[model samples]
Target: MGDLMHAVGYRKPLPVDDPESLVDAEVPVPTPAAHELLVRVEAISVNPADVKTRRQADPHGFRILGNDAAGVVVANGPNVSRFVVGDEVYYAGRIDRPGSAAGYQVVNENIVGHKPASIDFGDAAALPLTTITAWEILFDHFGLQPGDAGTLLVIGAAGGVGSMVLQLARARTRLTVLGTAGRGESQKWATEMGAHHIVDRHDLVDSVHAVAPDGVDYIVSPFSRGNIDNYAAVIRPFGHIAAIDEPTGLDLLPLKPKSVAWHWELMFTRPILLPEDPYQHELLEKTAKLVNAGKVRSTATTRLGPLNAETLRDAHARVESSATIGKVVVTR
Candidate 1:
């Protein structure tokens, strides 16, 4: 319980290539508030959200910028009941708070879950954010049941969120998964993650239609900006489309003809706006059970050495490239 700890952060938004975009520093160790846990972060994973936040958030003062993390609970708030000191846990912390890219961070207990004992910190670090997003989309948004059988098309299926979407759907539902990825390695990765059919991203409509001729029953997309037409063309009437990315100038006029339902998923919503909700904790617990049972697997495809300014910068750069096949994690 040191008064201060080492961390990497930025004071202003800058390009990833800038030397000061991410810097090493020492900050006072944060103490847990009501219903919070003070974690000694052991591992962290990078996501497009990290990159987007780095580019958009002002921070004003130095601000740490990572969400997906696995670590040990070093302290807990007075009202905390879900976890205590020495407990291993994983979570995608709230975006409004200081993040997990530090030696210690405080997070609400309701949003945290026990880290699956079967996986190491790095692999466990890669699961929370993406798994929560995928789970919410499948069950909360789509209302998919375990017995319901239909086709689900996941855009950007080789990426972090997409990878989890594929695995969770396979483990929790009876949907025939169709994933969109580029040729070669990406396609292979998607298949290994449980995609029954791999649709080429370049030929979105035709590739999806080729596999599910009648049209897919549900679609989850991370990149929904330029693929709206293709989605509209390939989604069956009354089908649901859930997206996590922010697409500009998005008009739902076209989808109206098919009565397609478009849902937006932001994993941070529950943690930030509805802090009292216990569903994220419950969801992560179920996800851990699946992982420990060998039904869902970690998507940590690239390990970028240890957690530090240099390595975090490289991890951010890799995610910014928009070509990362799976999650990239950094260990302590």
Candidate 2:
């Protein structure tokens, strides 16, 4: 392996629109730990977290800001058992580590899964982070059952995570999926992604109540700060509310009256804290099965060019715009 490889990274925190925010440079090839696999990154998907992380990047060191990735395993650590050197894999790598913006990365095998055979690298790259998040939020947090009968409301439904949540809820469970989108295109995208009803983001509470007079059984708020109060008002008794974004000044006290359960889904939980948890691996494997079976499809709608400074900057800008309908992926 070479001592240094090409990568797109930033040395100092700056605005996403700044020309110097993301740069192409050379970085050292990382080695795998006992439980890690060294993967040659083929494609990467940019998420809102990438933009958020870049805005808070350290001023001293180069930070590679990417999370969703699909690639081939070039090498494996001594303790790795599920994957071998030639296998293709996909995963949302740990946030603490230098991400998949580079030529290669070291990720724990427990959090990685085999790439879906039916899709290309770009499509496969778009699934891991959002899929992991949606799966955990729906099944683990809300305890989704196959025959469940109720409405599931998803805030910001056109984005990557919400798209997955809509598809999974529609495919695996019998819930009526209600997705919120502000624009006309986003509403269409949400409906095509599996939303049974589209609620306007401008009038979240009323729009949701119009379709679901009895109130929704579950709420997945990908971006929930502004509507937290309304969420408490619209949810049915004993309903569950799951969120993944970082909301400020959030008060759950209002939910007490309805006996609503609040839950938070963070995809990095297993890789960062509970390393022994096999659910991430298990779920990714299941997601691959669902994809191959045509039950769920990729949300990668925008394709930026190769993994370079110009393309990455474009991706970051679009993500910061808060108007992207689906995942933005860049290939090697």
Candidate 3:
């Protein structure tokens, strides 16, 4: 309803510890384009993507970097039909556009889903990005059918995306889920999220082999660079490996002998590269159903005050530390 809106963003790339890394400012509320909904963002969750983007040089002046958000629809473009004004919705928005750090953001109606009736805004905000990621990795990339019986090895299972992956794999599919977590608390969190077994990432190969014996059928590595080779070594023939992290100089040759299928899942790809693909919308809607039915739960572990630059910096630091379990959400 107002012209000015509160937003947190950065003018230049800097380390998370830098005071100027993220700054609070007032920006004009954005008008929705065709097929877009203008959302009044109520809560947002910080991901590693937020931290990585902040450290990159942005020639395009100030940039708002947040991926997951839940809010009420303030307005809708004439062409939008999936949502109406006052609808509570959640989504992992497109990276090519301005992100959800602002009080107001415009997102395509197709990529957004109705908020789950079982959760609050902060809890709902925690699901979109990670849910989309894990969903895509399982259904789109891995292509496993329901009642499919096999072992799934999820690296970084205590983190946001992996937590969702563990839950979805356990609840929807018949996959025996093996998750990795180094710390005691993290291991507990992973088990709660539905991992059948917890393996120390330090002993990834031996620990996994001790249980599976013949290697795993599927692998989802949210943070893969360090232990990718171990994954290659422990994967069964024709097993699928999907990753979300940006691992450089990865040698996939080791998988060639086993004919392993490797794929990368960037949650923004459907919204950015293939807007015509309706899978994201379907996945979000299904995820909401799962959450409402108590099949899956929100992973918002830490709430860092209100959505502001100062709090965002703290969230970024926590994510960068790579010790947090589940998702860290910031609310209004």
Residues 1-332, candidate 2, lDDT per residue (tens digit)?
Answer: 78788888898888877889999888889889898999999999999889888888573688887899999999998889899999999999999888899999999999999999999999999999999999999889999877787889998888888999999998899999998887889989999999999987788788888999888999998777777789887899999999898887788888999999989889898899998787888999999999999999999999987899999999999889887889999998
What is the per-residue lDDT of model 1 for residues 94-200, given as tens digits with 9 covering 90 to 100? 98999889999999999999999999999999999999999999999999877678999998888888899999999988899999888688999999999999988
The model with the greatest lDDT is 1
Q: Taking the candidates one at a time, how many backbone clashes does each contain?
A: 0, 0, 0
- Please identify model 2 stretches exceeding 4 Å from their true place: none
Query: What is residue 299's positional error in candidate 2, in angstroms?
Result: 0.5
| TM-score for each of the candidates | 0.98, 0.97, 0.97
Candidate 2: C-alpha RMSD after superposition:
1.3
Cand. 3 Cα-lDDT? 0.90
- Residue 177 lDDT (model 1): 95
Which pairs clash in model 1? none
Error of 3 at 6 (Å): 1.2
Full candidate order by lDDT, most accurate first: 1, 2, 3
Candidate 2 global TM-score: 0.97
Please give, for residues 1-332, the per-residue lDDT of candidate 3 as tens digits.
78998999999998889999999989889999888999999999998888888888582888888889999999988788788899999999988888999999999988999999899999999999889888889988998777888999998888888899999998889999999988889899999999999987888999999989999999998777777679877999999999887878887787898999999888887898888676788889998999999999999989987889999999999999988888899999
